[model samples]
Target: MNRLLRTVFLTLVGLFIVAPLIVILVASVSTDEVLSGLPSGFTTRWLSDALANDQFQVGFAYSIRVAAIATAWAVVLGTSAAYAIHRFDVPGKSLLRAVFIAPLSLPRVVAGFCFFVLYASLVPAAYGTVGGVAFAHVLLLLPFVVSLVGAGLANLDPELEEAARDLGATPWQAFLRVTLPRIRVSMIIAAVFGFLTSFDEVDLSVFLMPADTTTLPVAIFLRLQQNQDPVTSAVSSLMIVGSLALTGLVALAARRAGLFATRKERM
Candidate 1:
């Protein structure tokens, strides 16, 4: 009876989480009347319309470019910072860790506003450009990379590095051949998170995107502000599907790679 109850509970939770997504997916393909509850049948017109629009395509491409670049930067910087903190005996290590992870604690709006104001004051023309967006994204997502990579580093067995060193491997070679392979999962996770953060960002992108440049989230937001229709729903559903697919792939990959295991299990 207890096992049955647990299974039922999980089933309910799954339904609760997935029902909305299913509804959105259905609505994305719905006709205008179905969308408005006026009694029309399913139609793909909205999807076609969304796809045909130049703004949607441009914004999507822009978002992809920014997210890819930002994820790369975040992984590189975050991994390096985590490695330094984990490997070196630095002064005020606790304080440094706190400082490095501080960005994650700030409200998104507050951080975006702060960056916008500071950059405007220093480089007024920087706002509303790809560089500005990438910079903001890196700042916002850096903490995730640091934390995730740091966890991997913390749980790493230093004896492996020592063993490699004793085998006549140089420090660089040992890290490249041994340490990096062990932490590759953490790096992938950080990259995925960084990409998602940049792709879905709104507050910062709103301030940073130039008049000619926009991201998918920002574009969707602006469109919603002006109108709400099946077309809007279609775009939203597409974004949701894309995000979920990426997240699902990441989770599956992590599971397959044993990255989701506890430290004890990994050991």
Candidate 2:
């Protein structure tokens, strides 16, 4: 009975998670039958229509650019901060750590509004441009990078770094040669998280994006209010597939880095 119950629970959980994605995939490939609440014979018309739209392509390009820039900045800053906080004894370390991660606790809208006011009121020109949007995205994703990198750093071996230094390597060299290689998985994970956070960001992007430039999420959101069509479903399906692929790649990297070797390693 217990085994049967467990099987049922797992089945339900799988169904719960997969049902929406299945619906989206089906709808994305369905013709007008999607609007009729039934499975239409599969057709690629929606995907073609979505791809033919210039707005979608432009928004996707802008989103990719912004995500790449924001992720790069976040990974650089976050990795440095994580190493400093974890591998050294810094003053106000606990407070600093909390401050680094505090942004994640607040609502995104609140964060967006704060940035909006500060940038618009204080630096109007900067706030109304691509640079401003990228800056805000970095700020929004920094905490994720910091937390993930810090966690990875905490689990790293201090002895390897010490040995490198004892062998006449400078502190910087020891870090770069020994510590960095070991903690690279964390950096990669942080970069992935930062990219996703920036890519899917709506609240911050919506406020920061000027009249001329808009990210994919904001553009799609604006369109959704006016039209709920299969084209939207096609775009959403693509996003879902892209996100899942990225996640799979990250997971593979983590596994190769011995991240999931055991429960203790995971912790």
Candidate 3:
């Protein structure tokens, strides 16, 4: 009975998570009256129209550029921060860790507003620039990379690094040869998640956006204010499909790296 209940619960949870995506995907292809019923007719025209839109094209390009820059910076800085927090006894270490992860503690709208005020007041040059959006995205992504990389560091056996040191490897060489290789999967996770977070960001990016240049998410949001366009559904469908594919790849990579051991494997 307990096993049956567990299976049922899991099925419910999975359905809850997937139902929305399924609805959106179906709506994307439906020619009309999705709110009334299932698709009356199937058409790929909406998808084609979204692609042909000049604003969406520009927004897509802009989002990619910003997300790339944000992910690169976040992974570099967050990895270094995680390493230092784990590997050293620096002063104010607890405070530093709190600061690094603090971004997640605030409501996203509040964070966005705070950044808006900061740039508007002191850093006028950065306001309404790609650099501004990228910087905010780094802050948003810092906690994810730091937490994941720190977990990876914790799972390492210290003796391996010590053995490398005993073999006369310099500290850098020992780290590169021993520690860095082990945490590679974690880094990949950080990059993938960070890129996705930056790309899909709307609430935060909206505040920092330039008048002329906007991210894809921001463009989608602005269009949403105007009307419920079929193009929106089609675009969302593409993003949903792409994101699922990317997540599957990440999961496969993690499993191969021994991060997702099966129950029998654990035994």
- Candidate that scores best on TM-score: 3
Ordering by TM-score: 3, 2, 1
Off by over 4 Å in 2: 33-36, 250-267
Candidate 2 residue lDDT tens string, 1-267: 999999999999999999999888889998673456787478899999888888888889989988998899889898889889988899999999999988888888988888889887899887756678888888888898888888888888888889988999999999899888777877887888788878888887788766456888887888888888889889889888999899898899788878657768757
RMSD value for candidate 3: 2.7
Count backbone clashes in candidate 1.
3
lDDT of 2: 0.84
Give the Cα error of residue 114 in candidate 2, in Å: 1.2
Could you estimate the TM-score for every candidate? Answer: 0.88, 0.90, 0.92
Candidate 1 residues 1-267, lDDT tens each? 999999999999999999888777778887653454433567888888888878889999999999998899989999988998999898988898898889878888888888889778998777777777788889888899999999999889989999999999999999999999889888998898789889989887887766456998888888889887778778888888888899999999889878778779988
Off by over 4 Å in 1: 33-40, 248-267
Candidate-wise lDDT, in order: 0.86, 0.84, 0.89
* Winner by lDDT between candidate 3 and candidate 1: 3
Q: Compare candidates 2 and 3 on TM-score and give the better one.
A: 3
Which model scores highest in lDDT?
Answer: 3
Cα lDDT of model 3 by residue, 1-267, tens digit: 999999999999999999999888888888883445777898898899888988888889989999999999999999999999988898999999899888888889998999999999999888768888999889899999999999999988878989999999999999999999788888988999999999999999989977467998898888888878788988888888888899898989788867667558968
- Candidates, ranked, lDDT: 3, 1, 2
